[model samples]
Target: MPRYLISFEKDAMDHIREEDFPEVTKAASAVCQEAEDAGVFVFSDGLSYDDGDVEHAVVAVDGMVTDGPYPESKELIGGIFVVDVPTREAALEWAAKVAVACRCAQDVRKFRGPAGV
Candidate 1:
């Protein structure tokens, strides 16, 4: 089975009021449960909302480690779901369910096999 990544942008949750988070979370959790029940779920997790808390590391050519959010991305990953499925269409279907559950758009990508095979 091929694994697909389903992810959401960080800014999408910025406008959600604290009080409403529980409901939104409930909906999203339900989707995760569904994925598990279907046996397609590999892993799922959410990122911390505080960007300041994130430590980005860069490994130099000589293996020196530097810390910072490199590449200066305008968007951050809010959450992610790794699902192993049979086809791209199946992945897209899962993404759609996730988007609705999360109340935000989702970005889907297929994982490259080992050694890019």
Candidate 2:
């Protein structure tokens, strides 16, 4: 089995209003449940984009400690699921389901180098 990361950028969900979040959450949760029942789900979570979290990011270089994510990339990982599936097609199918549930595009990529490879 190969592991794939199905993810989306934070801005992808920006169009979703706070009032509509519950519906979106329900849809996304359904997809996660489907994946779990299908035995493909390994782990998944949505990253926090709160200003406090980002502002407090610790950066260390040569024992020097600093705060904040250096370079400050415009995009951030909004959500991700690690799934162990039989093939790329299977992963894509899962991604499609997720995209529909989240109402956003998904990026899918396989993990590097299988065990002992």
TM-score, every prediction: 0.86, 0.86
Best lDDT goes to which candidate? 2
Model 2 lDDT-worst window of ten: 52-61
C-alpha RMSD by candidate, in order: 1.9, 2.2
Report the C-alpha lDDT of model 2 over 1-117, residue by residue, as the tens digit. Answer: 999999999789999899999998999999889999999999888988687674446555767656655565676788998899999999999999999989899999999856789
Stretches of model 1 off by over 4 angstroms after superposition:
49-54
lDDT of 1 by residue, 19-84 (tens): 988998899899989999999999988977555764557677898887654465677788998999
Error of 2 at 58 (Å): 5.4
- Off by more than 4 A, model 2: 54-61, 72-74, 114-116
lDDT to native, each model: 0.87, 0.87
Which 10-residue window in model 1 sums to the lowest lDDT? 49-58
After TM-score superposition, the amount by which residue 38's alpha carbon in candidate 1 deviates from its true location, in angstroms, is: 0.4
Q: For every model in order, what is the number of clashing pairs?
A: 0, 0
* Colliding pairs, model 1: none
